[model samples]
Target chain A: MDVLKGAVDFVQNKTKVEVNQRDIEKILSALNSTNHFWEVIFLSQKPFAVVRETINYLISIDFVKTDESGNLILTEKGKEFISANNIPVVKNYTCSCCEGRGIVFSEIKDAYEKFKEIVKTRPDAIVEYDQGYVTEETAYSRIALMIKKGDLVGKRLIVFGDDDLVSIAAALTKLPKEVIVLEIDKRLVDFINQAAKEHNLNLKAIEYDFRNKLPDDFVKSFDTFTIDPPETIEALDLCFTRTISSLKGAGCAGYFGLTNIEASLSKWYEFQKLLLNKFNAVITDIIENFNHYVNWNYLLPSLESSFAFVNVQPKLNWYTSSMYRIELVKDVDIKNEYINCELYIDKEAILYKEN
Target chain B: MDVLKGAVDFVQNKTKVEVNQRDIEKILSALNSTNHFWEVIFLSQKPFAVVRETINYLISIDFVKTDESGNLILTEKGKEFISANNIPVVKNYTCSCCEGRGIVFSEIKDAYEKFKEIVKTRPDAIVEYDQGYVTEETAYSRIALMIKKGDLVGKRLIVFGDDDLVSIAAALTKLPKEVIVLEIDKRLVDFINQAAKEHNLNLKAIEYDFRNKLPDDFVKSFDTFTIDPPETIEALDLCFTRTISSLKGAGCAGYFGLTNIEASLSKWYEFQKLLLNKFNAVITDIIENFNHYVNWNYLLPSLESSFAFVNVQPKLNWYTSSMYRIELVKDVDIKNEYINCELYIDKEAILYKEN
Candidate 1:
C-alpha cells in the first residue's frame, strides 16, 4: 500500500482556493465513488467505521479542501505540490470483479477468512536466500551515517534507479540540494511522483533508461552519482560510464558488487575491475551480506584521478545478508599525502613525512 | 580484497589449526597478490598511506594472532572468542604488485608519493574504497552487527558472495557457526582458499552458478541463508526460493531488491507484493535512496503467515543513496499486547486508556 504523504502534499501545495467542510465532504463522496478509491476500500473490506475514519483522516490532513462556491477543489498548493512531488492523480476506473466494494462481493467472506487463517497457520519453513539486493534499512543507515559524516550535503546528485531504496533515501534524507531520479519505467516515474507529492518532498524523477542516452538536462550536472544499474555487468558498466561523464571534477560514485558465491565470483571481480578503469574513486565503505539472504557487497568510492578529477571517500555498512554500503567522494589530488608513522607494540612508532 | 574472517572461521571450526603471526602474514601476503587486492589498492592508490595505516590498525586489534610457525592464526582465546560469537573467519591475501607495499610495481615510489599528497589533504577519506569486491573494515562491522543481533549464533549460514566484507563478517561474528561461500571465479576461489588456510577460518569457498540448479548438498541444510546472486531479479527470486526450501522452520532469510530507474512504478509495487505473497513476511524496514546517483531500495520483511507455522519477526536494515535511515519494526498483535493511554495537559493531569 502506498503512503498517504503524496496525497497530503498534493492538497497542501496544489490547490490555490480555500476549502470548507462542505467542499471537503463532497470530495470525500466523490472519492468514495471513484473506481480507484472504491476498489481499494472494497478490497480491504475493512469496517465502514474504519473507512469513515480514513476519510476523516484525509480531510484532517488537508488533502481535501473546500472552495468559496462550496465546492471541493484540490487546493492550488495541493495541485502544485502533487505536480512537483509527482503524486499520481488517478482517473476514472472501476474494478471489474468487486465493482467498488473491493471485496469479491460473493458470500464467501467466511471461506476466505478460513482460508487466510489456515494459510497463516501453515508456517513457511523454506528459506531461500540469494545475494543480489540489499535491504532498505541498511541502505538508509548507510546514508544517515554519510550525513553524519558530512559527506552528502548540498552536492549535485544523480541517481540511476528510481524505484529502489536509493531513491527513497534521497527523497527522505535531503542530502542533495538537488536530486535527479532517472528511471526507465514510466509507471515508476508516476509512482515516485505520487509518493514524493504525498511527503511534500521536491525531487526531479526523470524517465530514462541507462541502456539509452542520459537526458540532455543531466550532462555534467552532478558532482556525486550512484550506479545500481541492472545486474548485467555490461549494463552496469554502461551506466557507470555515463554517470562518470556527467560527474564534475572530484565527483564520487557507489556501485553494488557481487558477493563471494561460487556462481558470482568471476563476474563480481570483472565488474570491480570495470569500475576501477572507468572512475578514479576510492573504495571506502562496504556492507557485507546486508540481507541474511543475499550475500552482496556495495562499493562506496570517491573520484580522484586525472581522467575525471573528483575528491571522494568510500563508506561501509553491513546487515544480515552479505550486503555492503559503499560511499565515494570526488576530486582528491593524491600527490602530496604520505604515511606519517607505523606503530608496533614493541617498537617505537615510525614516522614518514612527505618530502 | 576478501576479509580474513572467512578463512579464520574455516580454520577455527573446520580444522584444529592455531592462527599466529606467520599465518596472518601469509594470508595478508596472498591477499596483497590477488587481483582483488590489487584492484582495491589501485583504486585507492591516492590514499595509499591511509590504507596502509588502516590495515596496520586492524592487524593490531588483538583479534588477529600469529602462530609460532609464523603462520597467522587466531589465539586459542581468539578462536573461542570468534566461535562463541559466531563470527566468520576471513581470509586475507597479500599484494602481488608491490609485494604488499600496496603499490603498482612500475610506479611504486611515485604512487606512494601521490598517495601521501592525496591523504594529507583528505585525511578523513578511506583509501581502499574500490578495491576488490569489498573491504575488510566493512566486513568486520557487518559481522559484529550480526553477532549483536543474535542472527549468527549457532546458525548454518550460506553465503553466495565471497568479498572481504562477507568473509570477514562471517568469520568475526558469532561462534559455532557453519558457513559456505559460493563463487564462480576460479582465481578468486584459489585466492580465498589460500587466505582461509592462512587465517584459520572455517569457511569453504565453492564454485557454482545459479543458472544451474543448486548443488544437492545445499538442499535443506541451512538455518540462515544469504544470497547476493547476480542482478537479475528473476534469478535472484529463483535462488531465494530454492534456498528457502532448505531452511528450518522459523529460520530467517534476507534478500536485496534489484532496483533501477527503469523500474516501473507498477513493478516496484508488484515486487513488494510478490515478496509478501510468497514469504508472507511483514516488511518491517526500508533504507531509502542510498545515493542520488542510483535508484535502489532495500526491503526488510519478517516472515509470517501459516506456510511454515512459524511466527518469525524479520528485522530489516536498509542503506540508501541519500543516507537516510528508515527503520521499521513489525507491529504485530498490538491490540492484544498493549493498552493505549491519553493524557491531558491543560488542567489537572488526567489519563485515559485508548480503545
Candidate 2:
C-alpha cells in the first residue's frame, strides 16, 4: 500500500493527536473539492489548528495549491495520490428542508410568524455579556422541539439567558405552565417583561447576574431549562451546575448549544464527561450545525486564530453550533455557588472580551 | 396547581426509574394528537411498558378513549384538561426530505439503485441468529453518512455481522481500502463472498460466531467498525469489547445502531456509559430513528409486553433505531476472549430466541 509518510509525519509532529495516512486521506479528499477554507473546516470538523497546519504541510509538499480566491485545489501529485489511495471527495448532502436539523418549522408556521413579529421590538445583542442571538427561526424551532419531546406542556421552563428570546417564543405558544428568564442584561429583562405584559402571557424575566448564586426559590424549582453555555470550562461548570441545581429532580431534560469553532474535540470530551459521568445525564440528541447565529457585531475583527491566516472576508452562517438534548437519569443534587469565572481573551474565545 | 397525582403514582409504581408529573405530561401531550398506539410509543419515546400503563391509567380516568378503529381519541374530560393546562398537540415535523434522519441519499442514488438490484438475490433474514436488516435506503444512508463523516476512504473497515449487507454496499462505493465482514451464518458469508467476487470488490467475509475469540490476523487490524449490537447487557459487552479489540488504536472510529423500541432509557444510559467512560471514547452524533428496518419474519410473535394490549395487526415500519457515531479519544485496551454470553429469552429481545 502507498503511504504519504512525510505528510503523516508532519501532521503528527504538529499535533499530539495521531493522524494516520487515512486521516491525511480525509484532508486530501476535502481539498479535491477545491472548497473555500471555511467550507473545508466545516467539512473536516477538526480543530482549527490541526486542519490549518495539515493544509500548510500539504501546500509545502506541493500536493495542494491555492487559487486567487483562496480555495484549496488538489495538484497533480495530490490527485495521483488520492487515486492511488482510493480516496473520494465527500460532499454534504444533508436534508435541505430543515437544513439537516431533523426538526421542521412548517407545523409551527403561525407561531413562528407571530414570534418573528414579537421579536421586532426585542433588545439588540450587546457584546457586554458576550451576546449573539440566533435567528428567529432557530428560536422558534426550539419551542417546537421542546414540545415534541414532551418537555414543554405544563412544564416549568427556565432560560438561563435571553439574548435569543426563546422564552418569549415559548410563551407565545402558551404550551408551558410557566416560562422564566434569568438574564444578566437588564435591558433584555425589561424588554421581555414588557412583551409579557402586552401579550398577557405567563412569562417573567429577572435581572440577575450569572456570577451570583440563584435565590432560594429559584433552586430546585424548574422542570426544564435551556442555555447557550459560555465555552470556557470555568464558565461551563458554573452555568451547567447552576442549571442542574434548578431542576426539580431526575427525569428532567435540558437543551443547550455547543459550537465547534470555539471548543475543541478534547473540550467536547470533557463536556460530555461532565454531563454523563459527573451529573448522571444521558445525551439523547446531538445535531451538528443545528443552531444558526446571525453574524455578531464582533465578527469584523474576529478572534485572531480562527481564520487569521486567511485574508478574505469570512463566510456568514458558518459560525453555527450543535444542539444538544440531555435527560437526567437520576435525581441531581448540586451546590448553588457563586463563580467569578470571567471570559479570558483568547484566540478561540468568540463571544467574550477583556471585560 | 392541578396534578395528575394518581396517574403519576401509577407510573412511578410501575417503574423504578422515577417518572415524575412532567414525564406524564409528555404522555398526555402525546394523546392530544389521538394517534395510534404504535405512534404514541414513537411520540412519547418512553419504555413500552411505561407508555402502555400510563395510557391504561388515562383510560381508567375517562380522560382518553379508543375509537372504533382502535386509535386513541381525547374525551371531553381529556380535552378540558388539555385546554386548561395549555398543552398543545405536538406533531412530528421532522424533515420529510430525509424522513427526520438528517441524512439524504440523493447523492448516492445510483449506488443505492445498484444495491437495490444486488440485494434482490440477498439471503433471507431468518430468526436463528436474530436476523433483520434495515431498509435499502437505510443501508444506503449508512454508506453515505460514513463517507460524509470522512470515515470511509482509505480506511480499513470491518462489520461485525452481515445481516444488513452494509459491507457489500461500502465495497460497491469503492471508497474503503478494504472491507471485512465476520458473520456467523455460513449462508450469508458465502453469499457475500460470491457478490464480492462477482463485483470485483475488495471485500471478504468469514464465517465466525461471535462467541469465539478473534484470530490473530483480525485482531487490531481495523480503522473503523460497525455493528448492531445485541440488546442484552452481556451480549452488548461481548460484541462491543470484541469490536473495540479489533481497532488499530486511538483515533479509530466506530458506528453502531441503538433503538429506543427495544432498549429503554436506562439501557441507553448503560450503553452510552459503556462507550464514553469504559471505552475512553466520545459520542459525536446521535440521530434518532435513523435506521428504519424491514419487518422481520419474527414480528407476529414479537416478545410480549411491547404493545401486548394492542390487538391490531402491528404497525408496519415502527421498528426504527438510532444511528450513533463515536470516536476514540485515547488508546483502547480491551480483552479479546471467548464469551459465553447467549441470547436471553425475554420480552425485550426481539432478535434472539432459545437457539
Could you tell me how far off, in angstroms, the CA of residue A321 lies in candidate 2 after the best superposition? 1.7
Q: Worst lDDT window (10 residues) for model 2 chain A?
A: A346-355
Task: Give a tens-digit lDDT track for model 1, residues B1-355.
Answer: 1234544444434222222222333333322333232222232221222222223333465533433332334445444544443332222122122121111112123422332332232112121211123223223323433332233545566766443325434643324267776665555466556545655767678875544555667765664555433322354355545545545433244433222222212223344443443533323222222221111111101111221101212121111111111111111111111222221111110011111
Note the Cα lDDT for every prediction shown.
Answer: 0.36, 0.77
Q: What fraction of the genuine interface contacts, i.e. the true contacts, does candidate 1 reproduce? A: 0.00
Can you give the lDDT of residue A301 in candidate 2? 58
For candidate 2, what is the DockQ-based docking class? medium
**lDDT of candidate 2 over B1-355, digit per residue (tens):** 3457787788667643346565577777778864677677666666555676688888888988776667777889888988887776867777778888777877777777778888998888887787789998889788878878877877899999889999999998887899999999999999999999998989999998888998778888998999987777777778878888888876678888887766766677887888777887778888888888887665556643333345445576767888888877777777777878674333445432222
Off by over 4 Å in 2: A1-27, A60-84, A118-128, A197-201, A300-308, A344-355, B1-23, B56-87, B302-308, B344-355
Quality of candidate 1's docking, in CAPRI categories? incorrect
- Tens digit of per-residue lDDT, candidate 1, span A56-159: 45555565453343233454544554445333322222222321111121222332233233223221111111113343433443344333222345556677
lDDT of 2 by residue, A105-148 (tens): 77668778888888887777666687889988788777777877
Top candidate (DockQ): 2
lDDT at B215 for candidate 2? 77
